[model samples]
Target: MGAPGTARRGPVGEAEYPPLSRRSGWSEGSFSEMKYYEQGTSAERWERARTFFDAKRYSMAADILGGLVEEVPDQVGPRLLLARAYYHSAQLKRAEDQLRVLVERDPAEHYARLMLGRTLQRQGRDAEAEPHLRLASALAGDFAAL
Candidate 1:
């Protein structure tokens, strides 16, 4: 028998493993086959980006999200997330550019319209923003009182 604190080795000379570290929750070789972006790519990237942003790692999050958006340009969610990252980082111009693309691609996307309206309003383009806000409100059934 092995010592109480030591693991017994098998015939192949592999020892029993200890518990995983609490800090990273990952073991060596365990994550070797995992891709950061696959299957739930956008959502996983978004979560990581948000974590970075929340931790005040704006530049890191922005860099990661920028790559994600570039790799998945057709995905509106990632684009919107990238725009939000830019907006949070005070890169309003880039945010506006991303949102503009979103509007062009999906005219009826209410959230995109609302965000675009907000961005326009921030830029003092009230006239341009009004229609977008109106469109968003209309689509969301919030325009009845407007």
Candidate 2:
């Protein structure tokens, strides 16, 4: 016997049932999060992220790009955008982490080196940033800046 008020059918066998609640992971408050960021195809999400970035909503762009970067770690574009979003949002540690990965994956990537150096510099780690900055300058063939 179920709990008194939990039965689907009424006591008199008149087939009465309560209306079902939504069986989704999302609630009303999270609907926009799901709709704009989580529930789209890769292309749609990428476009959404770009839109957010263009709107200067860096954190929202980062949230979407973070997932895209994770899904295709080998792809440089999403990771670069994710890192840029982090940098613009003043998420220095996260920007540094993503830039480091990008640099490690492609050491000759001048942009990633430049970004990593800048990220480190923003964190007040000049000593750690020097080598990267020099390398980025060398890679870009602007040795006068080095």
Candidate 3:
């Protein structure tokens, strides 16, 4: 009982995030978390995530991107999309964790650092966010001087 061809059956099998009920409006039924991850290769899933994101279905994108990030942890794009999904969906801690990883892996990843700073600020950790924000502005090099 899933939306069209979305859910299938398979993965690490614990609920990584909440169910897909929030994204389901098709009257076809809800998606199984496993089906979401198991139905596609990494590239397919990445495309699905992007489509979901562009549609503003952040949770759905997050769901697909989350598994893709785990399967290809070295791929910055999926992880960045996952972080954006988390941030947009207000899953602040998860977003921070992902952005922090990106920042650490490539200290010059200014966009990630900017997101990390913003996530921290959202969590009311402005003091901790300042350094990263400053660094982001510096790396970006065209912002109004902080």
Candidate 4:
């Protein structure tokens, strides 16, 4: 017979079998707790940041957006808006860096690719700009004609 409370293993080792419910730390209440935790705080931060950006206070906007990005680094909207603020403030190199990260994270974002290409063109780096423009054109398809 096997050891106490131990079941015989199949093709795999004993550890390979699914654990009993008590063995896992999770309980049914964990999801509910997470949902409740995220209810209103994030929305409030986003609204405040958007208002700052709309006021044309680019430095303040950058600060707020930078904090937001740090809190939620994977959020595309904050990154895009931060890049826009940098561009409007004549921080072309910072804008380019932000858009480069965005494009690398999401290659399918044609708008980001196009904007990056245009920024590079403005910086007089046509060689570096060409590939992004081409990618954007391909993604935009026939609509690129407009």
CA lDDT, candidate 3, residue 126: 98
Model 3 worst lDDT window (10 residues): 24-33
- What is the descending lDDT order? 2, 3, 1, 4
lDDT of 3 by residue, 18-105 (tens): 3344444322343333564435667788888899999999999998888788889998999999999999999999999999899989
For model 2, the superposed segments whose C-alpha errors exceed 4 Å read 1-35
Q: Candidate 2 lDDT (Cα, whole model)?
A: 0.87
TM-score: model 1 vs. ground truth: 0.65
TM-score of each: 0.65, 0.76, 0.74, 0.64
Residue 30 of model 4, lDDT score: 43
Instruction: State the lDDT of candidate 1 residue by residue for 32-104, as single tens digits.
Output: 6645532255668778877887887776677777878888789887788777778777787888999999999
Give the TM-score comparing model 4 with the true structure, all chains together.
0.64
lDDT of 2 by residue, 1-146 (tens): 34333436667889775533355344445555564465677889889999999999999999999988988899998999999999999999999999999999999999999999999999999999999999999999998998
Better of 2 and 4 by lDDT: 2
Which candidate do you rate higher for lDDT, 1 or 2? 2
Instruction: Give the higher-TM-score candidate: 1 or 2.
Output: 2
RMSD of each: 9.5, 7.2, 11.0, 14.0
TM-score of candidate 3 to 2 decimals: 0.74
The model with the greatest TM-score is 2
Candidate 3 residue pairs that clash: 8-35
By the TM-score metric, which is better: model 1 or model 3?
3
What are the per-residue Cα lDDT tens digits for candidate 4 across 63-114?
Answer: 6677677788898999998888887777889899999999999998998898
